[model samples]
Target: MGERTRLKRILRGLERRYGKIEPPPKRKGLPLIVATILSQNTTDLTAIRAYEALLERFPPARRSRPRRNLPRDSDGRIDKIKIRMVHVADARGEPNWRAIEKAPLSVVRNCLRVCGLAETKTRALRSLLKALRKETGGYSLERFLAGCDTDQALDKLSALPGIGVKTAAVTLAEGFGADLCPVDTHVHRVSGRLGVVSPSGGRNGTFRELRKILPPGTAHAFHHLFLSHGRAVCTARRPKCDSCPIRPDCERRGLEEV
Candidate 1:
């Protein structure tokens, strides 16, 4: 069978085994960005805990005054308000990003210590927030989210500090429900093993190839289902090929020794 046909069959099997995949509720802008960054190299549960700790430690600040008569910055080049007035309450009262930007690195790192690469993540957070403020005059991604060009939006997002193609694709996928498949470890492994895509170029290459063949409007489901399959049945150490729903269709590449 053609790779595309096999992929469709595998999708059906995965859906039968795991149930219909639902797109997560839309989470735009900063909160989604922060969550994505926190999730790096860590389990989703651990990332949640770290994000919660961060929110608790640096709770949302009181709403800023109206922007009708906004003030200028120190440089006085623009009329950008020193405080972020918009989108502050969008996260059901998101953590005070301004506080995070100014907080000592050690303090922020402590909040994220539960996750991997705490120090690196801390620096990234600070740099990311600051860069957003400078670039957009606030901690907001509405501009990218609202853009008509997907590639342009991806480029802008990927240019941010500590964000790569995977992160950018994930942000667009989860945050705005964009038609982009993020190639993480799970997606990379599962797709490769299933023979849907060659893994010769690693995650980035797999991502590019997968996008070319992914069925229309199925990126969200494809990502979630493959990720679930990888985690539960096609695991790295000991995949349960015997019980795998897609076993019949999977190539089982690199599993002979396993």
Candidate 2:
């Protein structure tokens, strides 16, 4: 069978093993922008925690206060008031995008310190918001990019601060349902070991090449499957190649033994 056919089989095995991989609900464009930024050089769980913390602190409040009907969590207490004021020292008003855009760099730095590289990420968020404001007259990306094609959106988003092919791909795929695939560290390594892409191709090149080879309408699921497979079976240090579901298809290119 051909490599593309083997890829399809691998994808099928991943689906059966892990079920369908869907972007979580409520993850629109703006939040995804921040989440993707926070996700760099960190565990997904840590990135998720940082993202929720960011949203919980900001809450997209139309005014200084969070929504009146905002529900309390398992901890109990509808503390939107407190959450809203958590960044009062740094934010001019509430912890919303407007506040972030106008807030002094130090305040924005404090707000994002939970995630690593607070200084860099804070500037990126502010810069991204500034760009959105220019594009849509305010904080709206999904609506602005609604009519844009995958390549167009990719090009635009990749131009943003701290954004590149991988980050843009995550945002475009989850937010706009774009068909482009993202290539991260695990995907790069696994792809090289499988002969799916050249070992020297690099993440950006792998992304370009993978897009041409992967089956249509499969990029989103394929990205997550590669991630899961990288974490579980084909780990970097000592891959469980013998038990890997796609071992038959993998070329084991650089593998010392299996």
Candidate 3:
């Protein structure tokens, strides 16, 4: 069978075990961005708690920075450096852009502390939202993307502070239903070991190669299968390869314990 056919067969095998793949009822656009940020290095439960806390702090009519150029001394050395004046405000209606843009840094940090790297995440959240405001004249992520071409959309999303290629690709796949998949640790490691995708070029390269080899509209399901299988059968360590449904297709199967 062709590689794409093998991929489809793999998906079918996993689906029989894991059932359907469905994303949760997430708040699209801005909220989706926040959730992705919160899930950076934390567990789902921890991230959810932190996200909920943020919502409590910045409610409706509210919700949710300017950079100053540094002046150098005559020596062209750092004599006096200006601190970035973090802007803050209180929202009146709902947790909206106006509220997030005006909220103080401390509040945003505290709200997301449980997710770890609160300070960094808070800054990213603010930076993206502010960028959105500048681009759209308001906070409409869908509209912003709808107007931009695929490459343009990916570039803008990738340029965001906390958004890496994986996150940006995930956003496109999950949020916009694009025919692409994001490779997380599970997907990357599993793909590498499966010998389906090359081990070089890291996760980004794997994403590219997988996109080329896999059939259209199957990237998301392929990603989901790798994730579920990676966790349950073909794990990074102590994998249950003997019990795997697709072991015959796994070139490096059980190499985890070797």
Name the best candidate (by TM-score).
Answer: 1
Give candidate 2 regions above 4 Å deviation.
22-27, 56-59, 62-95, 253-258
lDDT leader: 1
Off by over 4 Å in 3: 22-27, 61-95
Q: How far off is residue 83 in model 1, in Å?
A: 34
Per-candidate TM-scores read 0.82, 0.81, 0.81
lDDT of 3 at 121: 87
Collision pairs in model 2: none
Per-residue lDDT of candidate 3, residues 146-172 (tens digit): 777656777889888988777677667
**139-229, model 1: which lDDT tens digit per residue?**
8877534644778878877777778888788777776778888888989998988888898989999999989998878887888788877
Give the local distance difference test score of model 2: 0.70
Tens digits of lDDT, candidate 2, 37-125: 77677665455456555556665655453223333446785333122111221222223778668868887677567767888887788
Please list the Cα RMSD from the true structure of every candidate, rounded to 1 decimal place: 11.4, 7.3, 13.8
Predictions in order: lDDT: 0.75, 0.70, 0.69
lDDT-sorted candidate list, best first = 1, 2, 3
TM-score of 3: 0.81
